[model samples]
Target: MNAFIYFPVYLVLKSEEEYAVYYLPTDFQSPELFVPRKPLSDQAKRAGWQGFLYDLSKVPQGAFIRIV
Candidate 1:
């Protein structure tokens, strides 16, 4: 049998928008660059870092949310 695992991701784009939410696969090296290529979700700030956790995934992909 084959096993599968998924990691949820929350990230911020370089534009005016805040961040994006998606899922990433875990068994192999991801070919995607974590770029928001299309229409991103509307900005909604949860209280005190809520919802999914993307800490590890963010570091390698470098999807940190910077306020500019």
Candidate 2:
């Protein structure tokens, strides 16, 4: 089986003085990636980014896994 889903790549910055990271729209990059699909939290929905959620458990391994 073949399956695909789209997700926005976030450019997170680690705080120089803290362990926290920051996610901002101004910082982003284009990269091919595959990850588990899950529901977006209510807080994330307010971010206004577009994405889709799909169960990929049935998809065969190596079908979408990317190796660098």
Best by TM-score: 2
lDDT of 1 by residue, 1-68 (tens): 11224444333344465555443335422433333333334563433433322235434553443333
Error of 1 at 21 (Å): 6.9
Q: Compute the lDDT of residue 6 as modeled in candidate 2.
A: 33
Candidate 2, residue 65: how far the Cα is off, in Å: 24
Question: What are the per-residue Cα lDDT tens digits for candidate 2 across 11-34?
Answer: 334566744333322122222333
Worst ten in a row by lDDT for model 1: 46-55
Q: Compute the lDDT of residue 32 as modeled in candidate 1.
A: 38
Show pairs that collide, candidate 1.
none
